[model samples]
Target chain A: MTLTLEKSPLTEAAYYILLSLYEPMHGYGIMQNVKVMSSGRVNLGPGTLYGAISSLLEKGWIISAGESDSRKKEYQITEFGKKAVDCEIHRLEELLANGKKITGAKQ
Target chain B: MKHSTWRWISDYEKEEKWLNEMAAKGMSLYGFFMGKYTFEETEPGKYIYQIELLENFPTSPESVAYLRFLEDTGVICVASVFRWVYLRKEAASGPFELYTDIDSKIKRLSTMKNLWFTFVWLEFIIAAANLAMVIYGWLVVGQMAWFNLGCVVFLVILGLILLNFGLKPARKIKSLKREQLICE
Candidate 1:
């Protein structure tokens, strides 16, 4: 099935997960990076992290980088994932722009 | 010291809640087999437990890979029996949840509901066969049919119980899916 980028906005959890994968990182490293990058606002629980990784992998947004000696597998985002992030950023900017116009707030 | 207890439970929500309550009281899951849960004493509320229901048993290669992924995320697998996998992580490490978004939660619930309904249909088929056999035997065996009737009755009852067990999760899945659609 063709996935439409317009149907659903990127969730904060998914966005951060994709963001953390700009470099190859293992599962635990992804969780830690998400927590730090979100300024402690978003914490990806193991279950949530697992589901996100599986979904992204299935969507061809991420690929396995390799496995460490510890048997922990690492993942890195694909070009598709980078495009998805850009689309989300554009959508968010539109929302911000519309909100500022309505509130007559200068930024 | 290793401690063990057995519980016959099919409902996932109840089992997850009960296991977490046990963890809060210092008995954390160590392993499980059949209906027996093994625990090693740990600090109260030191661990958080999460359960996932799979369509196939845990021995499958897909399931093994899935569990390995969770382990890589720092979650420990405590036990797996049939289609249910029990997992726990130190509470101090962070939240012990596996699903943080509604979409993933909905997908998982749907998978479990489908599994339950498959069992219900299988039970239904057995019940139908039992009734047919009892009726056929009654026509041919004359007065020796009471035993067959008793057997058929027992099968029917068991089937009904299984049907109820299946329907509960099916209902929960429907409601959750509806809620998810509404949110969308």
Candidate 2:
């Protein structure tokens, strides 16, 4: 589903977390993705990760896809979550283009 | 809607054993077990108190220090400070009235020693005193006095703010008590 660019409002951490879960991922997998994606600039603690996962679940942005053994549960983004991600990407591209234009003008 | 009241030691070991025994006996109990001591009205005149979760209380160095300080002070000690405990069948009963036998005013004072309450009051008091000093110095003592007063006030406010923020870790000790009471 195509998402419009107006309704995306989330913190950078939340946005990155949802982005990381494009494929089926578990808690640790998401944590690892975030670390690699940010080049270690954003290291989420276990407590914070758990809290973020719960909030995302409550918002219906993510759902438990399956469990890998009893210890680790994998999750996947919903169609709504994908739309949100698309919206954010569009917004970010606009920001980057605007920033480039401003910097080019300065030069 | 029945409840029972009893006294148990506020010490961590004894309280844990008692809670285990109570659980084993198939009783559902919930309430805080607190020990409190009021120091003499000297420079550091204050009351020291500890609340232990009857089930999983912490036995750490800081807890030991608090208990020891109470013992050394020779202050009046109140123990087995549970308000109400219920049986398993009686668990969903409504809240019952639980009163401390101590004077209400004195008990109210004890609540002030809580970190949140103390920190708020400390900030207000320091702010008020500093404002007073600033106004008084400007009117009477001159700019030098005002500058001196400003320096003292700044240091005092900064110190109190740091102390207030530092008290957060100690709040963790209270969580241990809460965990013990929470029925899981």
Native interface contacts kept by each candidate, as a fraction: 0.82, 0.00
**Candidates' TM-scores?**
0.85, 0.39
The lDDT values for all models are: 0.80, 0.51
Going through the candidates in order, state the TM-score of chain A alone for each one: 0.87, 0.84
Best by lDDT: 1
Candidate 1 residue pairs that clash: A47-B98, A48-B98
User: lDDT tens string, model 1, A40-101?
Assistant: 87777666677788888888888899986787898999888899999999899999999989
The docking category that best describes candidate 2 is incorrect
Q: Which stretches of candidate 1 lie over 4 Å from their true place?
A: A1-8, A68-71, A103-107, B139-144, B182-184
RMSD of 2: 19.9
Instruction: List all candidate RMSDs to the true structure.
Output: 3.1, 19.9
Pairs in clash, predicted candidate 2: B53-B177
